[model samples]
Target: MNIVACVKQVPDTEAQIKVKPDGSGIEEGGIKWVMNPYDEFGVEEALRLKEKNGGEVTIVCVGPARAMETIRTALAMGADKGIHISDPAFDGADAYTTASALAAAIKGIPHDIVFCGQRAIDDDSAQVGAVLAELLEIPQVTVVTKLEFAGNSVKVIRPIEGAQLLIECPFPCVVTAQKGLNEPRYASLPGIMKAKKKPVDVKDAGALGVSTDRKARVVRFVPPPARAAGKIICADDTPEGKAAELAKLLREEAKVI
Candidate 1:
């Protein structure tokens, strides 16, 4: 199996997010970054499939130069190689442009399967995987929690509202892995050393014929309003007084009563 998994670098989930002074975009200072967590499932699943079939797994990510760190992490975890498609134009490109860039990169490689996270952590756009499949004109599944190989076909189990649906599809398909699909393993010390020797391919969006600078641009960014402080009144507090206070705040202050 030649599995191509798409990964990404995102602001660390624990990092503090702040907008620029003029609200043009993220402050981009004093922020730590890491691999998109959801993408870990896709990487793990690809590695597992390679172990079973004795094939190759390649990871792809698009971001700034620092994004290579995220790719290196995957290589340490056992991917054969990685490709980074990035440029300044990609800084604020929307999901459509991003997907186009990915498809262009994938078009240059022949693989039996493509794996991706159900959604990116930063944008949470579940659009890329599905859009890339459409551009590639291949069968694809999303929100897949379980996968099994059977002869020439593969069976996928996807969670529904309260249950799951088991669907079978042929090989050479795309799948967006969901969380809990598998536990991601840590790279051993030796593996980390080996990753340094792994090959990394870097390409820009222009090389892929997809311009990162699109018609849309980030005009500004503003943080959400701060949460209001909460107050705790003793259970014995007067119910009438509490109700009256809530009414006054909702009606007079909130103005949405």
Candidate 2:
């Protein structure tokens, strides 16, 4: 089995993010970057599959030069190598353009299965995996929580609104991993040392023969509005007094009851 895991570098979830003054994007100077959290599940799933099936696992990413750190992190987690799609032209590209480039790069490599995160935290668009599958002309199962291999096919379970959907797809397919897929493993000291020497192939849009024209553009970014403070009801010590005050507040202020 030859498994390819698509990973991305994104702002750390807990980091305090600030929008740039120009309203173009976030302030990146002081922000901490890490591998996209959801992509960790995809990498871990790929590693596990390789361990069980006796094959190689490759990590692929598309980003600026800083993204090499993200790729090395996956290498430390046991991916055999990495492919980085890096170019200034790809800087402001949208999800479709990114998927097109990634699909083109993957075409140059041998792969039986492709894995990706359900979504990128930064954009939260959740469109790349499905779009990549379309570009590759392969079957795709998104938000997969469980996966099992059988002969030449793979069975997967994905979450719906209130239940899980079971799906079976053949090899040369794409799978976008969800939160419950598996717990990602940390890199050991030896693994980290070995990762420093692993091969990471860097390519650009032209190298992949993909256009960088963005179909979608971000006009501006607005931060969410601040939350309002909650109201507290203080009545006399009696339970009835408190109950009556709460009732009045709910009826007049909250208006939910």
Candidate 3:
């Protein structure tokens, strides 16, 4: 089995974000980057599948050169190698453009299964994996919480509004991992040492023969408005008086009742 895991580099979830002075995008200075939290689940699932089925796990990422750090993190977590798609043309590329580039890269590699996070935290578009599956002409299951391999088929369980959905698909398919899929393993000392020697193939949009045209563009970015101050109410000593005061406030002042 040859498993491919799609990962992304995103700003650390806890990092403070501020809009650029020109309202074009977020300020990158002082912003720490890390592997997308959701993608970690996909990487962990791919590693588990490789361990069970005797295959190599390949990490794939699309970002600037700095994203190599994210790829190395995956390698340190047990992926066999990595593929990085980085090019100036890919800058400001929308989800479709990104998926097209990734699809081209995957086409050049041998893969029986592809794993991706449900969505990237930066954009939260959640469109790349499905689009890649469509471009590759393969079936896909999204938001998979549990997965099992049976011969050439895979069974997966995913959550819905108030229940779970069980799905099955054959080999050469895509799977987007959900939060409960598995716990990602931390990079050990030995793994980190070995990862330093792992091979990472870097490719660009032109090399992959994919177009970098973006179908959409961000017009401008605006920060959310400041929050309003809270109001406090003090009432009389009697329980009935306090109840009346609360009701009056809710109905007239707060207007919530």
Best candidate, TM-score = 2
Residue-level lDDT tens digits of model 2 in 1-257:
99999999999999888888888888888789999999999999999999999899999999999999999999999999999999999887799999999999899899899999999999998999999999999999999999999878899999999998999999999999999999999999999999999999999988889999999999998787988897666799688998999999889888989
Lowest summed lDDT over 10 consecutive residues: which window, candidate 3?
230-239
Instruction: List model 3 lDDT by residue over 1-257, tens digit each.
Output: 99999999999999888999899998999989999998999999998988988999999899999999999999999999999999988877788998999899999899889999999988889989999999999999999999999889799998999999888999899999889999899999999999999999999877889889999777787888988986555576688887888899889987998
Off by over 4 Å in 1: 213-218, 237-257
Q: Please report how far candidate 2 places residue 19 from its true position, in Å.
A: 0.9
Clashing pairs in 2: none
Q: State candidate 3's TM-score.
A: 0.92
Positional deviation of residue 15's Cα in model 2 after best superposition, in angstroms:
1.0
User: Model 3, 29: alpha-carbon shift in Å?
Assistant: 0.7
**Runs in model 3 lying further than 4 Å from the true structure:** 233-257
lDDT of 3 at 118: 95
Ranking by TM-score: 2, 3, 1
> At residue 97, what lDDT does model 2 achieve?
96
lDDT of 1 by residue, 1-257 (tens): 77899998988899888888888888778889888887889999999988998789989898899999889899999999989987887887777788888888888887788998999878777888998888888889889989897766679999989898999978788899998889988988888899999998889866788766565455767899898897653344799877877777779877997
In model 3, the Cα lDDT at residue 119 comes to 94
